[model samples]
Target: MKMNTKGILFVYTMPLVLLHESYGFFVPGYPTKHISVSPQGKLLSTRSIPSTTTKPSLYSPSTSTSSLALKSSASSDDVQSITATNKLDSILSKLTSAFPFFVLGSAILGLMKPSSLQWTNQGTLISWMLASVMCATGLTLEKKDFTNVLAKDFAAVPAGVLCQFLIMPLTAWAIGRTFLLPLPDYGPSLFLGIALVGCSPGGTASNLVSLIAKADVALSVLLTSCSTILAAGVTPLLVKVLVGNAIHVSGWTLCEATARVILLPVLMGMIVNAKLPNLASKVSRFTPFASVVLVSLICGGVVSQNSSMFLSSKALLPLIVGSVMMLHCVGFAMGYFVPKVGLKFSEVTSRTISIETGMQNSALAVVLARSMGASPVASLPGALSATVHSCLGSILAGYWHSKNKKGKEESSESNKKDFTDRPEDDYPELLI
Candidate 1:
């Protein structure tokens, strides 16, 4: 229901903090040592050793974390500490690292407006960005990974895909019929909303989000890989079954469209990744920012064009809110449940499914909708999904983070209790 820029802002800003810390800047307790200059004010080549009698200087990680913490805690103009050089260096570092994402976002923004480029021209830009990202994904992969596609894990892939392609679509359809059908002319948009969820792939951020939530990282990756590989085929079929009539859909048409816009790019990336791993690696590094920029532009364009439909569609708000909530919940649940369905959802896999389901490829939805010449209303589902997913994912991940923290605390407390209650003489080995 909300556009969660918090993650994007963090993604854009964290590097700055890291850069500042790495550069011996304003960050406190960051191991900055003083160096004396010669009388001529030139830098001294030789460093003086401290007296042997001096105590060893303390360096604490807590102190390092706390020093950055201080910067965040300060009141306006209350500047309690920090060197001007360090501050400037820190600021500069942040700016430099964030520039690429900024520029990419700006370029996408400019391209989204019809005034910015011809219709034919836009395809090249989208293709370039997608191709670049795919290449990146390809570079990181090995033939060994695909082996899993044929192994026992293969069934899990379909199980997970079924959840995405089957469960999610059905849920959306039911919700639309029950809650959205009442609104006149909103029928197609509702179907469009369901299709948007049905057609999306696992989001790139799912692994990290799963980790943040303290879920299974490996399982998350596996499910994502399975679901994504199948998305190109499965997404369209699901859409056809759910909303074919409402949107004048044809299975072959959707399938071909999926192959071009989604499948081919992915396969090409895989091929490149297999053939030139180094090139794939280089491109992968930039894909995260590039993908974000692409999605942002696509969403912004949808919003801009459909501002009226978004406002007028009475079911718009509920549809957005309900769809996101349901999709996220279903993802998390299926990730958990399906693992238990004989695939053995490792602690990590459950976490992975939880994240993968929640973060769908909403950008693809927008691109697909726009490509189909669907109304801006049709694009609304994608835009709303994009806006809501990021925000909801963050909140969910934060919740999992908090739970993990609490679990650790409880375990610590239990350990302490046992230690305190034990007799040292009875179990002396425990003392070690």
Candidate 2:
């Protein structure tokens, strides 16, 4: 017997189709449907039926009528289930896409009702929420992603990490020293806050921006993971070296805390993704929304707790804002230019590095400041840093998204023109 192309394809894909159907049965909250395969191994419609419903008979004369009725009922149910699934997926996509808006809204709400999210100020709650966000970051990764980076693009990861650590902290220091000299009492606290923001790793929010900008998301993730792991040691050491005399910082304690809040949860998430990929994938769908909510709450908590202090700092507010803006602006500029000019990276890679470098993990900075008994005013910079970076990053995302869309349309039109201009004689004769 001779096998056709369809037969070969079916032979290869049948196992996957069957496995998917089997997995669907165990997926919670979603109704399982039976997938019908045609004789030629083409996929037919999946029909949703109650668990108690019997399978339709296969081409039998005696039960033909009953089988038809059963199939009809199952088909109706399948249509409804499919519609519901599509709607749910659409909602999730919208939520994920509007991540920046949600963060901004949460910050406004935090300012309006400071007391509502005040409970998030507790050290334990902040730690858990940050850990959850880190876990979500890890869940999106695969072992192969890391291995590919190690084998093929090792330099990119380190370059991004170096820019993150070097550019942000130094810029923070320079801006703080220049702008914050006038205020003697709260000046040191503000400087420490800015330094903490600089020393921290790239925020998980950068991953969302990278996705929107059509940048190198895998490289962004790798940079985030590596920088965060290094943060345990590097953050405290940098703080100590730069501002140790101004304020006492425990490098060992900060290192331990960072490892606990960031590394541990991320490792656990990676393990779960590796071992329970199905469950991880399901959970991963909601993690972006969850991260936004958690980050919002964290930012809200900081803003709420420091609302009074923020209002009171009218004299130093401009300087504080200016310093934070400068820190991020420098980060963004150097991040893109350095990679493009010095490292000779592509535009997309440079954009990704710029975003990852510019957006620091301000939440971690807030948590560390609070845990270490830094001035409450110091924590205010973190809240402001989060808001500023999100706004800047969102604008960048919109610009890149529009540019990519335009590029695609132009390329599509050019291809159409090329095809129209081609001579018919250039086409090969069809074998069939």
Candidate 3:
């Protein structure tokens, strides 16, 4: 019985092997004549088999088995390429997953020893680091990706952008006025910092958060890119209009700085990607990881620099913390629900917009705050805001990730049940 079963298996598989070999010669542009070694160690020329014939029998030994071998070799190369791409994608995903932890660790270390990372406090250093972050963002983008997302849903981008500029800055102003402005000494500087946080563009970090949250990552990137570029014009204007009395700010200077640090770097990266995609891809593989490190350093530097102020203002720390947290929470809630209620967008798009709107480019805000000659006390909010938003975003990401996993499992189970209910003969081609 075992010998009979073995014979049956060989009978079934041998036909498939022979059919595969015969089909290889019929491939378009393949040479009609190829040499193969038969079981008898004789050279078999496959020219006897007609290439135009639709059906070739396995019994025909005239097949060019060499062509089959060549096809198999090509398939192996394709599999290798696919494996490498998957490995690269996995590495990038891991980096994104651990982003919040890196930010937190750096902040803690900076607070513990303010002098260690003090070199990062220079205005020039901060500006260049920010430009690098923007450049990394640009490397990930393509012209078609943006156009595709925008063309698919025009309302989403515009609405999100409007919310980003409108909601965050106004929230910041209200929070500052209610909480910080009433204080005696640090009121003006603190208000200025908080206002700057509100006025700034959607952060690059939001893109990573969106990815983790299983939200619309493409939309997140587009929103961040658009807001960052427009920030060159809009951020300074908002500052001038809203907080001009508290702190003297030159809109023109701020605009120039925004252009220099944010716009130029992003454009340069886009140009590189267009011209040399292969090079850009290689560089971008590392950018996500690099951006996390850069952000951590920027946040850590702020904490280190302001450690003294933070200690002295322990009485007001809770208020400051509460105000920043409230500002972000409001931004997140409004960003999510506004479109769901007003524009009637899907939950995913709304989530993406919420993240983009809630998370401000606090690093850029910190740079602007210091460069514009704001006091260290004023700059503390941006630093604290950075840490606060990262934690909140990470928590939100964890929730979304688990929810998405559960949803996928349920969908898979339903699909399995459907497959089981179907008759086998209904998919005759699949049976082969």
Candidate 4:
């Protein structure tokens, strides 16, 4: 299985590299000379004089008033444009920070009326939505961000990853055995799903959540990728040991899915950003809010599709819910305190580890669960996991964003200088 997975990784990687290079070669997103940067560093377009008219130099005495007037008008226009743009960013920032509410509402809506989100439950749409979210994450990143992770934050990778495999899987097995009442009568298969989720690597969504929370997004992405690569060996071994020989998952196939859903989309987004920085910056302004929406939809759609499975029993509801909820909360708590208190890392780095540890590849869990040869209902735990982890991560992001903003405001008032460097446009911070 390991060898096969390696083969698959090689096949997928070659094509992906070619495609990324092809895109960069064909669409080098070069900025035009007409593009101008305002004093505030905002991009603007300046029109050239007509061929029939000679453009007067600003130094010429004859056009001094005209130049002054033009400068005044242009400055006025720039102010209006910047004001409008900032206002839009402020609105998006509010909305993005409130995404926990949106996600929670979506989950509730999906549970109540599965038919409403039923159309979006298709496999292709789900993949595309997830890809789009990941792409948005990639757009926010630059090559330097990754290099920083490699240089500074590389050591933290194994520490946090250990928490994922060591803590979550064992905790999951214990919880699954304890909480579930065996509703569907396929005990091992349902338990297998639970175990699989715990053993799964850090979610691709972690990268997006890290960005939103103002955590170490570059570290989160690196951790996620590293964990995924390790999952090929660790996942199967953990399942075999914990669950005692369930139907095996194809690690190569898993890698292929991940490459399509995560690696490729992210690389493509990065390529676009590197090639067309101006275009990327313009598009990035809207991506954070868009990602929140798509994540809500994806989670809600998963719940909607699996609504009947877990909801079939009133008794089963709390059992499944309580189990998964407890598992993720433990994951989040342990993930947070371990890095925060034990390792004595910065708050931001610890938070990044917390998110990466908390969010699992539940979609991968769902796919593996389906092959368990148990009833389709066995996949419910993985589906429920998606709702639980995403909601938790979103809430964490929302809370952290608000707290970070409050701190910035206090600091700015004391120092009399707005120091909030709005990094990567995860959300726009307005300097009031």
Best by lDDT: 3
Clashing pairs in 4: none
Per-residue error (Å), model 2, residue 334: 0.6
Would you estimate the TM-scores of all the predictions?
Answer: 0.63, 0.76, 0.77, 0.67
Candidate 3 residues lying further than 4 Å off, grouped into runs, are: 1-89, 414-432
Ranking by lDDT: 3, 2, 4, 1
Residues 17-136 of candidate 2 have per-residue lDDT tens digits of 543443212111222355554343333444454534432211111111112211323467766665555455545544544444555555655555666667888658987899898888
Number of clashes in every candidate structure? 3, 0, 0, 0
Overall local distance difference test of candidate 2: 0.72
Q: Predicted candidate 3: what Cα RMSD to the true structure? A: 17.6
Judged by whole-model lDDT over C-alpha atoms, candidate 3 comes out at 0.74
**Which digits, one per residue and each the tens of the lDDT, describe model 3 over residues 287-338?**
8778877877888888888877667767777888899999999999999989
* lDDT on C-alpha atoms for all candidate structures: 0.54, 0.72, 0.74, 0.65
Candidate 1 lDDT, 374-408, residue by residue in tens: 66566666656765666566566666655565565
Error of 1 at 236 (Å): 1.8
Point out the worst 10-residue segment of candidate 2 by lDDT: 57-66
Stretches of model 2 off by over 4 angstroms after superposition: 1-83, 413-432
lDDT of 4 by residue, 29-134 (tens): 2122233444444433333333223211111111111222113234677666655665566456545544445555666666766776778756467678767876
What's the alpha carbon RMSD for model 2? 16.0
Ranked candidates, highest TM-score first:
3, 2, 4, 1
Q: Which has the better lDDT: candidate 1, or candidate 3? A: 3
